[model samples]
Target: MKKTWKRLNLIAAACGILVMSAGQAQAMGLLQAYEAALINDPTYRAAVSENTAGKEFRNIGRSGLLPTLQYVYGSGKNRAEITQPATNFLGQPTGGFAVSNYDYTSITNSLSLRQVLFSLDATARYKQGIAQTNYSDAIFSARSKDLVIRLTTAYADVKFAEDQLDLYHAQRDALDEQRRINARMFEKGEGTKTDMLETQAKLDVAEAQVIEAQDNLLNARNAFSAIVGSEVTQLDGLRAEFTVMPAKQTSFEEWMTVATENNPEIAAAKYSLEAAELEISKAKAGHTPRLDLNAGYNRGLSDSITTRTQDQTIKSIGVQLVIPIYAGGYVNAISAQAVANRDKARADLDSTRNRIAIELRRQFNALQTSLTKISALQKSVNSSTLLVEATKQSVKGGVRINLDVLSSEQQLVAAKRDLAQAKYNYLISFLKLRVAAGTISIDDIQTVAAYFSPMS
Candidate 1:
């Protein structure tokens, strides 16, 4: 008995060391995962880069309305020889032809400025740029929300996989113990071979389940690593009593109103529609007159064959007007194309609204259903726990077999696993509902993070 006690102590000490080692491994919380994704996620980074580049569109459009100034300079050496039939002032032909040769360097410089005084097309294009910028901002906002949801889901997946593996391990150990008890009883001629064989078979199946669960856990961890851009050995687990709240807005119509106003996809579609409308106006303006203010200065120095070296400077400022007449019906064709595009844009906006509404409804129902399942599963877990204990007591009373106890244990673990999955599903559905409503934010992530205790 003393040696047995000593062996048990050693086993306990080894378990303690394992627990300590596991504790030493750093735990990644939801917020930390989100931060890592923000820095490392290629999709999010691409969205950021697109947003930054999109802001330049406004400047490009505004340039058309602003004054443009340019300066040009030219210098060249010129040599010229002229020969002509000799003709005197007295109008008499000479025996030899008159020849003249000249060589000189010439320089010319000019500065010009042009400012659009009135242009409908330019104004419409500028407005379109503003709308496009707004569209990019909405797209970026949507991507940010998507990142949050993705990271949260991935984190939950890892926790679920871990829980499953742990449950499998526990079940396998319990079955192994039950199998050993049956084997000993059969050797004593008390238990039947059938009972012992049943337990052994169950133990083998449990061992197989553990292997599968381990593989699942590995895959989940690898998926999480892909998102965080690093290998993850451990993560903070959800609290045992994490609460899932119902959505703030209940009715579909109420949620739809919020989504229509706040959803990034809807906003982007609206901006796209506005931009398309402006494009139509710009195309129509192609037939309208344009006015501009122009000013220029020119200076030149050159030696002429008929005159001595001369230098000249000219400065001029005036208003220029341009009236479009006809361009082989090109203007009309473009205007028609713009009108067609505006129709397409309008259709796109409608499509976006319909898509968002469908998603919002789906997520709303999923969240509600998950919440209900979580409640039901919690009660089921409690009942299964009591049943397992009762089965164990029944075995002691010789009314139930060891296989019965093992079956109860399996049911209890299964219930617990389902409950954990339900909870995770509830949380994920809640976040997805927020995403559909275009209201997901870092605050939501922080709230979820509150449910996780750091690895200790």
Candidate 2:
């Protein structure tokens, strides 16, 4: 009896250690994962690079409008030959001819500056550059939010996979225990061979389920690792008790209004439209005159055979005008193309707005439905748990059979799985709703992270 008690005490102590160790396990939360992804996610890194390049657009365009300076220098050895009919003192060409050859060095240096006094094309291009820069900002914003959505999705998938695997393991354990119980009863002649075989069949199915769940978990972990750039041994899991609130906006119209004003995709599309409209002006400028202020200083030495052994310098400044006359109808064709592009941009902007509206509606409805769905699933889990316990008692009391208990256990597992999925769905929907409204940010990530508790 003393040995038995000692064994029981040892078992209890071992279980306590396991529980403590599990509670102390290091875990990654959504915010932690996101921070890691910021430095590691290839897609986000590419977006950052693209944004950096996009910022140069403004500078590139402004350069065309600014004054440009150029300096040129040339030095070369020149050889010249002259053949002429000799002229006598009468200043008439004689029948005899004379040939001469000479070699000299020529040097030229020039500096020039040009500033656009009036150029519609350059002005329109500068405006378009500004608009394009703004568009890039909007695109980056959209991509930034998309990263959050993607990370959250991957994290949720890992969590769901973990939960599913855990439930499957538990189910297998329960079915195995039932199988053992039936085996003992059959050996004692208290249960039939039919009952034992049935329990074994169910246990086999449970084993297969556990195997599939493990595979799913591995796939989920791989996906999560792809975003976080490393394998995470543990992740903070959803809290058993958490609240899911309906969307703050009472109506879809309000969400649409907010999306129109704040959505990054819509903003990007609007900027693109603005740039396209400016493109028309730019194309039309091809047919207009351009005016510029030009200044130059030039120096030359022996630059020509007649000017050999002489040096010259000149400084000049003047206004230059260029008027377009004709160019094989290229200007008109390009102008028409620009008009077509502007129309396409306008249509694209409208399409973006409509798409945002549709997404907002879909997410808003899903969020509201998730709230109700989560509530119902919570109750179902509770009811299923109670039913499992009741069914087990019925089996022991002979009011039900082993099969009934097995069915109840399966039901309970299904209920728990569904509850977990609904919770994840709610979180994803909430985040997506804010994303569609263009209000999602790190704070939203933190808020969502709050729902994850350390593994226990």
Considering only N, C-alpha and C atoms within 3 Å, which residue pairs clash in candidate 2?
none
Worst 10 residues of 1 by lDDT: 16-25
- Model 2 C-alpha lDDT per residue in residues 191-292, reported as the tens digit of each score: 999998898898899899989999998898878777767677788988888885545678888888878888999999999999999999999999999999
Best by TM-score: 2
Off by over 4 Å in 1: 1-25, 89-96, 170-209, 303-308, 392-406
Each model's TM-score, in the order given?
A: 0.85, 0.86
- The RMSD of every model to the true structure, in order and in angstroms, is 10.5, 10.8
* Model 1 residue 138 CA deviation in Å: 0.9
For model 2, state the Cα shift of residue 368 in Å: 1.2
lDDT of 2 at 401: 78
